[model samples]
Target: MSPSSEEKNMKKWKTPLWAAFAAALVVLLSGVAALIYLDELYPVGLGPRQPIPFSHRVHAGVKTISCFMCHSEAPRSSRAGIPPLETCLLCHSRIIRTYPYIARLRGDAALNRPVIWERVNWLPEFVYFDHSMHIQRGIDCGHCHGDVSRMDRVVKARKFQMGFCIQCHRYNRATHDCYTCHR
Candidate 1:
């Protein structure tokens, strides 16, 4: 065969290989970036909308109420208990009755309709996070939940990723076993 023809053949063979490599690289980079984004959303909790604009800073810090007041059973159970209507009414039924939002809450309670608070900062369904255990073990709520008592809107300030949690565990000389977080 002519040398020119051989060179042309080689170029043709290499062209597809290069194209494939480029395509694979694009796919790989895209996947990596997507994973990074998902990691940011690790402890996926409530997204944007919350039922009532409850301010943690006002309720917990200004009022100096304990975390367990709203999450009454947090130290005793896996789930952080949502405050019942009566719980909120305990203060709101009289004190904040003039506030438009509090009036609405009072009306809802009177109607026997519960305020459906959108839970933010939730772990994956497969992952089990026990607030009781964490609280009893002296894991401050601020560690994983950021400074809730300082937040007005309660947006997620921490990336609840497995790696993030594990890093905390490592720093504190705690266990990072799969069983520790995941069910």
Candidate 2:
């Protein structure tokens, strides 16, 4: 082909190539923006909907129930165990047994089925956090969990990220070794 014809062919291909590249870039950016929007709508901090709405403000703040009353194992075990249905029934059986949500609790208790409570704060599987250790070290629940007594729906108080935990460890002069948190 002649030089001028080759140049014309190259110009034609360049226009379409640039247009295709721009189109792909727009699509990629749109997808990223959509994911960010969705995340904002349903943030990690916003607590999950439970099977039954249990208010920490009412129980812990208003009623003045001790944290240990519900989480009986916080001080003694690695896992701060979720209270069984019987714990709810202890007061609920007499107080609001007629309420529909309470009635569901009653039904679960009667059938010996556990109420599957949604977990709010969770670390990665590789990260090991002992509730007892923190509790023993005089770390109040609020330190990590935020003001749970004020929250009706217990949302994730803080981002349980590595940097956050590391900062805490450094401040408290706790073991800052990688193995201290990561197993």
Candidate 3:
């Protein structure tokens, strides 16, 4: 082939190559921007609005209530069950019995109805997280829960992603096998 023809072929190839690189860069940047936007819209800092505005700071921090007081089953069961309305009424029945929110708690207790509290820290259904196992292993609640005594409203402190769990398991020399968590 002629030198000029070769040069023309090279130029044609370079043009498409540069165009493809530019397109790929745009796509990468677009994905990053979309992630940032979604992160802002649904932040980990935001907790769900509970049926009653219960403050962890006031109860756990100020009153010095132990974590086990409200989550009575954490040490014994896989689930840290929400405190029954009767448990709340044990305090509210005498202390703030006239307050509207406390009144609601009182009414619910009277009828033996459970309060539908919104769960804040949630794991995917595939993963099996046992609170009792962690408690028995001497893992502090703060490690996963992040200073509940300090938080007025409980927010997700750590992203609880697979990488986070795997890192913790590997560091602690716990099982990092897929079945350990996935099952």
Q: On a 0 to 100 scale, what is the lDDT of residue 65 in model 3?
A: 96
Of candidate 2, the 10-residue stretch with the lowest lDDT total is 40-49
Candidate 1 residue 153 Cα shift, in angstroms, is: 0.5
Better of 2 and 3 by lDDT: 2
Question: Could you tell me every candidate's TM-score relative to the true structure?
Answer: 0.70, 0.74, 0.73
lDDT values for all models: 0.83, 0.90, 0.88
**Location of the lowest summed lDDT over 10 successive residues in candidate 3:** 40-49
Residue 63 C-alpha lDDT in model 2: 97
**lDDT tens digits, residue span 53-168, model 1:** 88888999899899888888899999987889889999887796899889888889889998888777788899888889889889888887777777777878787888887887
44-155: candidate 3 lDDT, tens digit per residue: 5656788889999899999999999999999999999998887887888899778999998888888988889888889999999999999999999999999988887798
On the 0 to 100 scale, the lDDT of residue 30 in model 3 is: 94
lDDT score for residue 155 of model 2: 91
Highest TM-score: give the candidate number. 2
Q: Give the number of colliding residue pairs in candidate 3.
A: 0
